[model samples]
Target: MISIRRFPIRIALCFLVSFPLWGCASIAQWAAPEKKATTSAPVEFVNAEQEFWTHFHAGHYDRIPQLLETYKRLYVLHPDHPVIAARIGFLHVWHLSERMRMGEPKASVIDDATLCRKFFGEASQLDPKDPRFKGFYAACIMAEADIHQREADTRKGYYLMKDAISDWPEFNLFTGGYVMSQLPWEGSLFDEALEWQWKTLDLCAQTKVDRKQPEYPAYATQDFSGAKRACGNSAIAPHNFEGFFLNMGDMLVKKGEVPVAKKIYSFARLSPSYQQWPYRNMLEDRIRKAEENLPYFRIQKREEISSKNPHLMFHSEAACMACHRTND
Candidate 1:
């Protein structure tokens, strides 16, 4: 893997940069009593997603298998439920991420990727109106491309992502941009991804974005109409604002804009949920080592960075913790 500094600095490269409750069902309805070992427990399909976030936020990896089985059962019961399919797809990605982080066999990763693609693709087809499903569908395709080393899959994923962006320009920009962030930081794709980040900010604030100044403080103070759950302090995704900035700031740091990156990093503090974020230290640490951290990050291939690194937003296990934790 080449260092980002050594990679070409094209003009375009300079140009740019969760979760919710299970459903309307009551929490009591979602909770199931412990059953005897011989007896099968009742599944809470309406709030299965809520249970997932509970386990995920608590770092209860051991509980995921049972929850996954529950989701699979729910999917069987509700094959038409796009949300269930999408969530199962997400958990499959998480399952594969754990494998990758642990250096599990390639066969396991391939299987997980295949399953991830299947469910997310199903979700996208079931509800084409939802851009999130479409974006993740494309993400799973790209995941397969990387795992299988297939250029045709890459092209297909890229086109699907483009269509997703066009369909819901606001949120999919972040989604598509995030999937692209794993690419070598020097490429045109990476540059376009940064530009997409800028576009996302403009939409988030509903104003022209100026990179040099601190806009987050104002973003925090002002109330805007139609702010999506993805952009706000959500119970299901408490650290979305924080994670978004961490990602954007990391991109800026890679581009040799450490000072500007520091500004970007501060945006994490704008979230009201920041104090409760278990990964808050990662942001502070990044701010303190903005320039010094560059060499350490540069030595690793972008895709090969371990998810265990708490600071690396996209790949980190903390990515789940960051976005989904309800509290410390």
Candidate 2:
């Protein structure tokens, strides 16, 4: 779509942006078993899991403390189990992330990043080679950077993304790690952001999720690939890649590249992942919104350049639109 260089700087955007296994549970299961096939959980796990699911599904969020304690005890019992540790980490990452994003008081009860490090970190340590844990551990760092604005966390996250993206062969985890690494911070303009988003979008389009399960289901110990499975079906990043495409198209529109942005936005319709926010309307409304604003961005970019840096000229709207005209 629109090139980052031509995209006019815009106001900082704030965008609002899993599972389990345990000891005896290998993170990866190599068997090509049918995804819909159900595996049974032990009585202890089933009972505890039922309670966790009861509150989890009932929307009893205040029960988070209780759930954390329950998972903590499970972790203690399965000290070597990265599965439990990852589950604990997922709880903090998924549940706490929303709370933290809203700046809630209950969110303050624990340091989100610290807990991420504690549980996901433990899982990574226990299974040092697993890409899921490694990538997610890096994700925790990014979360820390987003919430607390920590420089060290950002650097660490960047490094982790590089490593995880390179190391993981899977489509989902690495794409997620890539997006997490590339997402822009307040007032930050990086050339690679758009490219990363494009790649993340492609990954989302290509991924195929077989089963859709509710939250806090009692997942068995062994992972599909054989490593410790964390967060049940929630482990792989959401295939919809909402944050990736949202920022990508918005950035393009801001720069007066509505034509290219429109093409990019079209990919959303092809995606099978769970849709949220702008995607609720099939992204048609968002595309229309961007197109309507195209002229404004073009004029605004020219004006901004003329006033801010008189030495250089801005691309005309005609020139920008010409870049995306169909060849046929």
Index of the highest-TM-score prediction: 1
Measured against the true structure, the TM-scores of the candidates, in listed sequence, are: 0.78, 0.52
RMSD of candidates 1 onward, in order:
16.8, 20.3
Per-residue lDDT of candidate 2, residues 139-199 (tens digit): 7777677667788877887687668766653432433433342233222433354445444
Question: How many clashing pairs per prediction, in order?
Answer: 1, 19
Model 1, span 140-183: residue lDDT tens:
89988987899999989999999998987777888788777667
Q: What C-alpha lDDT do the candidate models reach, one value each?
A: 0.73, 0.48
- TM-score of candidate 1 relative to the true fold: 0.78
